[model samples]
Target chain A: MLIRRPPDLLPSEITPEPLARGRRALLKGLGAGAALAGLGLPQISQAGSLGTLRPSPLSSDEKLTPLKSVTGYNNFYEFGTDKEDPARHAPGRLKTQPWTVTVEGEIKRPRTFSIDDLLKLAPLEERIYRMRCVEGWSMVIPWVGFPLAELIRQVEPNGQARFVEFVTLADPQQMPGVRSPLLDWPYVEGLRLDEAQHPLTLLAVGLYGEVLPAQNGAPIRLVVPWKYGFKSAKSIVRIRFVREQPRSTWMKAGPSEYGFYSNVNPAVDHPRWSQATERRIGEFIKRKTLPFNGYADQVAGLYSGMDLRRFF
Target chain B: MTFQPTPRQLTAIKAALFLLTLLPALHYAHGLWSDSLGANPIEALTRGMGIWTLNFLFLTLCVSPLRKLSGWHWLLRLRRMLGLTAFAYGCLHLLTYLWLDQFWDVDAIARDIWKRPFITVGATAFLLMLPLALTSSHAAIRSLGGKRWQSLHRAVYAVAILGVVHYLWLVKRVALLDPIIYALVLAILLGWRVVERIRLNGPWPTRSTPPAVQPVVFMKRDAAAALGVPKKR
Candidate 1:
């Protein structure tokens, strides 16, 4: 109910008014044509409507991971710990429709915006980014969302706001992990202000030309392509700006194994296994992991002169 | 209505267990053939094999104590079969990690075994199992002699313990259910052995057995030791 209306779209926002309206009209025409042309195809998500965001200059041409693989296999520990647990258990278990993200702490405007407000507030973009898990597996995902920088810019972080922290929902009725003490509940994740503002940083709302699957962090999730997948917190409910570095779940759980930055570095191995190579989804042999996950040219300067292994 | 199975029946029982032990491997093979491993098949394959290795180790440990309590001497025969199957699974587990997961990256694997505690413990357990697996032969048993061979095989308890530690430490966030369940089962199995030992030896002090009673206890101890060492010749 709260995620369908864009009543708060300000005139000064990023997307120009005329262009936005024009695109909507084009999408409508395409949807109508699609329905009329074939077996009256009902699904028109791929009609460059719900998913077509701005084309990211930073994305790759690599083959996109299949939607089924992307949605069916996940590590949203809230549903359960297993990769398939979310797919099997999360369909009707969690409520995503009336989701709201509370933006607060050291910001000029600290307001709670419903999912609809988020969609209207920021212009979406499609980015085919590499997602590498800390457990040595990789996938190429086509994400649809606006830049996290735009969201941070809208909130207007004060100078004291140094780190951006995100918190996920912790409801036992929906999340089984909340009942189990496997992790400190209300899973928290963070990034430095600079990293949060990076152009590649995304606040994803959809994937594969469709709305985000409940299993894959529906409604809202953060996506930092350069870092391990865990750093990109899913099912985000709150974004708080703070002066000090925020406490992240994995880093809090095992500091030695999971560092705050969590940058994808083959040189620095996890405590239990090597991170030098990653098994891509559907591929048998592992491929060599890249520096900054192959976006070194863009992101390396952000950590200039800092020791990655030490920070990691 | 006797629990004793004839030699032919014993052979049939061993055959059934051997097939049962292959089920995990066969299931993994089917998964591989059908492309059902989902996303990272290698990770699935490696993890599955490693878990089965731990399972077989626990199953092998379970046999002795269960046999002791059940009063089924025939269960003793399945011990070697179970132990060897554990070793086979262990070998496959290591090979999967080495050949498929690491892609024969010997240097990296060497560094991993040396540096990582989980890998180190796992490698140690596998190495300990290796000597027992190698010596599982009629000629080796005959040459090593009963007392020495029995002493050598006693290393199995340590192997099972180390195997559990390796698995427990491997998980990132301590997947409690599997590890805790495994620990409980292992604790019970090993507890049985400990209780049986104290029952025969009496509490710590050696408690000065009466001169006449000592001979009878020594006879029981000798027979038990002999029972542990399988005859080869």
Candidate 2:
């Protein structure tokens, strides 16, 4: 789909001729010290004293430890079986500074918005979310971003828009993980009409305070915290509002293991394991997966009256 | 290429080889209990155990080839145990995916096996390993008789190939090194068998050759139940 780029920003990060990508903009506007310091919180907690005596501030409600930290720190298994693979390998390759998301499919304005345009459209807010993976593990990330609905409204959805399909960048040349055959590259994810419209869903651009690390889907990505991590498709390149149910990458790969809803519920057990419990990242010693990833009040209503066992 | 292997030495070697196959799975379980499994430990554990199971399957397939080509008859005794151990690790690999990855989500798991090619192949390999494991016991072997038992265990060859295909396709990219090594090992094992088949001309002959009209030993359907493998497809 053709996309109308915002008044500012280039179409792609890479240019034949030498030109600055977001380095100057990010450093000058955001402040390198502030950005680095913001990213340092996790590292400090990860490296510093991790024992029963000293728990992470992130785990205000739960007993936290290093095993719990593991769930949060290293999660992208598609990149490598190692937990730290995504973080260690993702940063430089994912050029986020010059990123723009192409919004198309059943929209009043089939346009592309620059990172700056997104920030100007709506102010950023931090939501402490508990992210549960389909693999029975969980993590709480204090994500800073804007509501997904706000962006959807800006595009002006057409009447036919019944679902939102999110596509991740699939550049094996840039993303080493894409080079692996673990999954179909450029991981795809989607949400139903109502679910996409839900207030809890976020079109996250940053974490801590700075723009999201490239490893964390830099620039912008979907964040359905209460659902499995796969629901939060990283490095979003396309945002399509479709009439039919979009085929999700993981669901298509293994439909039995991944459902359309993918809500975080202990009742539904993946054939190989029980979803009844989850090891909360950072709260390794004291982590216990809660209903709706401990955000029951915010998201439990969405799945009301539905049988999780069947959907799961 | 043929050499002599005694029944007594074969029995002992088979028992030891079986124990060796359990090491990887036992290591994984120990890691899980010791909290040594890395973050997202299940993936590593699952992948490790799965690859090991496939490795053992290839190793088991090589026994006859090694015996014939290397002229080491002792290899034959290790075949059954090696095959059984492969099945054991295969079971653990499947369990890890079910309990750790899918969380007992039967519908999701079933859908994955049906929809995903890798999962389908993996689940099939595991299922194929089950009959091999069940029939590894001496009692089942005795009941099935030698010829029938050998024929039943031949499923290991298919299971090994399927296991490799499952691993190869699971990667988003080819993951060139690991899968290639596995393929190479499997190729060498199978290749040796091909050579042995050519050398022997056909199935190996025993000390006793039947007279002009020897009574053929056929496995009765009821008795076939005792063998490890399902009656030939």
Where does candidate 2 chain B have its weakest 10-residue lDDT segment? B210-219
State the lDDT of candidate 2 residue by residue for A1-312, as single tens digits: 011123454344222121123222333454434444444331111212101111112222222223224223654544554566677777666676666788999999999987667766665555546677776566645455677888888888989999999987887677766666657766888898678877788877655434566666766778886788878988788889999998898777778778888877777666555576676542333245577776687667777897877876
Q: For model 2, how does the per-residue alpha-carbon lDDT over B1-233 read when each residue is reduced to its tens digit?
A: 46554677666766676676666767887987886766656666888888888877877777776676587766666676777777777888888888876678788688778766778888876776677787788887788777777666666666777788888776533244578788788877766666555455544354254211111122222124333345433
* Model 1 stretches with alpha carbons more than 4 Å out: A1-51, B207-233
Indicate which candidate wins on DockQ: 1
Chain B TM-score in candidate 1, rounded to 2 decimals?
A: 0.86
lDDT minimum window of 10 residues, candidate 1 chain B: B210-219
Scored by CA lDDT, what does every candidate get?
A: 0.79, 0.65
For candidate 1, give the lDDT.
Answer: 0.79
Docking class of 1: medium
